[model samples]
Target: MGAAQDPNSPVVHLPAGRLRGATEGGVTVFRRVPYAAPPVGGLRWRPAQPRTGWSGTRDATADGPSAPQPYTEGGDPILGGHGSPPFDDDCLTLNLWTPSADDAGRPVLVWIHGGGFVSGSGSLPNYSGEAFARNGDLVVVSINYRIGPLGYLYFGADGAPGAEESGNFWLTDQVAALRWVHDHIAHFGGDPDRITVAGQSGGAVSIAALAGHPDAQGLFRRAILQSPPLGLHIPTPAEYLPRTGAYLRLAGARDVDGLRALSWPQLIEAAQGLFGETTRWGHWPTPFLPVRDGVTLHRHPARTLLYDAAADIDVMVGWTRDEATFGFALDEGYATATRDQVVERIAESFPDRAAEVYGAYEKERAGARPVDVLMDLISDELFRVPCVELAEARAELGRPVWAYEFDFPTPALQGRLAATHCLELPFVFGDFATWSHAPFLSGIDPEVRAGLGHAMHQAWIAFVRTGDPNHPDLPVWERYAAPSRTTLRFDAVTAAVEDPVGVSRRLHHRASP
Candidate 1:
């Protein structure tokens, strides 16, 4: 084999091909490296397969194509303030940021970007791995996977080929990417044994699923699930069975042969129109999502962890202070709801604990703005409660777990949105300068916030390197226990606090699904 050195830069050669990456701040970066063959055409709706090995060098310059995403008017502002342009099916790719081309066996941090599972790419500027790689002396990776109906629809009918095994194809894509990392990251100077998987929102949910997946065992050593929710977008077999039938009927075929006869675009359009305006979940169709497939996922991720399914893995999980504030921002009516409106919405969203939830928040938030109180209630029920429940469950199972609550308010949105959802991304990735409209990063002293990012980033690296997060010079984080739960409070001055949101967490724990 020829020397792996780029000669022109610091990129190296892999068994599959040669890659040339850009040099920034003394680190060499490679982007959009394919790990599996595109799951298009006949392979559509099937599990991911390994990419055919290539000869000579392949350029790892620009980001790979992003999977098909719905067109939002402004698109994802966080993805460089513009919507993702149209792209093709070849989107299974990964990006790498490293200090050197030679194999140094450095700890690896693989990031899974979060966009509610419907949207997001690993190529976002905020997810850039340069700072974390250079500052922590670690190898950083970001990956892209299938999304929406194409990646998540379930077909369990007997006549359809592979339908019984196709419930979690998107998750299978993630596991395949990890397998690629295990077999190939060494060539990029990363230690596969020390691989740590981290993600937010839907990506975080995927991490939790991987933790419980039997096939995913040993693929990753540690995981960080930020703002993970328990029952987001989970489809039941009944929900999918009818949808599968509809697709078959629309294609004008009696069996699996007829279903496969329809074109990809035709199938996608039929699936998109499955859920009409009168449907329970409004505009969002419920055809495709991770289900209780006995093979890929035995049960709900939270239940799996609670029953000791993930007892051997190390985990850090938590939520933000104002997680639901974003929902209010998207629709102002949510912030200014009346008492009757709040009660009705609560009952509709959470019928089991509607009265108890209303009482708890009513007592705690007396005289507060209706919007603020509603935001807290929804945020807790949807995200915060689910997160703490996972920690409590893991602790019960004798697994090591650490929790946190990001409380610092953002200065960019004025005081309207406190430490809201996705606020932690810029801080974690050290991209405050780019978010000029962000209040927290713009108004606060950069020097003070700089240390918070450094400390949090280092803690992640420490957890990935070893199961324990006892880095020198940082606070000794205690494992979450029953009554006296200790959590890392990330703010201007980060410290450990006992039971940060005790009452709300307890109420939600008792009431959550």
Candidate 2:
């Protein structure tokens, strides 16, 4: 239904119904507009269906519930505040902030939040769309998809109808949201043809997978992958079934209905063991993530992108300098780790390439302790090398691939947390003060924040408008090419460097698992 009449409220008629939104800072924003029907009851574990049309204007002024998720245990502060908006099963909603609803043909940027596919919704304060709409004159849309076991766990037995359709339901939800944008975003003044799907970490991984999926083709013209874990491919049914079985046994569910009947607390309890906090690196013992179930998703996204899949779409990919610092901050022991401890951890994590991994990082990071070297190894393996490889692969296909490295460190915690994972988000969104009170951004200098934030926010706008991220405010950034590997390093002093951190790239190429 529609809200009470007010001059400040703006109304846009979506395909489903009329949506009344609030006008703030010269932009009209509609919060929590459903893109799909609630994925509960019979819809649970199945693909998201179209949101049934309504008779009146639905109240779009309030925030919506997020997918069910367990509490975040990491020491990173930014991760803690994500679950605050609300949580519910009927959570496949999207928020839009537009300059006007007058067929402006403004570029659309659809954001997918990062929580390793288990947590995070689009309504986080950090994801507020007002800045983008106010500053860039574009339509900014952020969406929420399924998370946790309800979104990723496969329960259908071999050849079972439920199991086949149940897998990749989260990806299905995202696709449904994109389809909704294709059909209805024009009403919100966004160009349906010029949509850019961008995400960080797991969200970036989702974009990578979407790039490979044939069904997702033509929905978006360009993609921006920020710190995607390229090496973390989707699991095969065989690899994931045993974990699913264990979850069933833990929950005492004898059948699929019994599994779906489990409550949120019960489901989280059954799946809690999957995420062990003891590991120094980010390794989920049982991740409820996308699987290569031969239906929704087929092959590894990074590999598929290499062979001309989504090659027609322009791409921009990059990662932060100290990507593993978040993992280390989560485990304090790593800060004071002994040299032997470091070697042992490396051997345990990468048994086949322990020597090569050690030699490569140690040679480049001389005078550093084994612990520091180990951190570098994990960082490169987890993020740095994978991002570079993705760019190289796409560049090899002769597509426009822009590579970057975010080297700007925050002045938080006595400078311990360097340019780590998730740090670039505030700058990209132009909301540094929003995260100033968070644990991860305690000592951020105002001047540094403004300078870097301006560069990043403008660059993203440039990317959305035209398929290129280059803007006059920044350096002459070049598209990625073999050997040359031109990359824009965003820092206190942004520079266009040629193949920054080549040592780690070579090591990853030599010792990849």
TM-scores for all predictions: 0.87, 0.94
lDDT by candidate, in order shown? 0.72, 0.80
Model 1, 1-513: lDDT tens per residue? Answer: 222344676556777776777776678788878889988766777788888867766667677777765555554433234225544567888999988877799988899987755567787666888887887788889988887656766676563664545477788889999888888888888998888899998789899888877777788878888887664546566665666666566556565545556655555565555544214421122445677667677667766555455667788887898887764644555555776777666787668877676777877866666666678876876678788877887787678898988888766545677788887777677656555533445566677778777777777767877766657746777888877788888888888899878888766556433
Model 1 alpha-carbon drift over 4 Å, by segment: 1-6, 72-83, 158-164, 242-288, 306-309, 348-356, 433-448, 470-474, 509-513
Each model's Cα RMSD: 3.9, 2.6
Clashes of each: 8, 2
lDDT of 2 by residue, 1-513 (tens): 334367557888766678888876788888989999999887888888888889987778888988888765442464445566357888999999999977888899999998877778898778888888888898999999988878888754572345454488889999999988887888989889999999998899899888877777789988999988766646888887776776677778865678777777678777676664212343433367678888877887666566565868889999998877776754566677776676676787678877666776787866776666876877776688888877877777687899999998777777776788888998899976566546776677778878999999999989988988888889999999987999999999998999996887866564322
Model 2: residue 29 alpha-carbon error in angstroms = 0.4
RMSD of 2: 2.6
Number of colliding residue pairs in model 2: 2
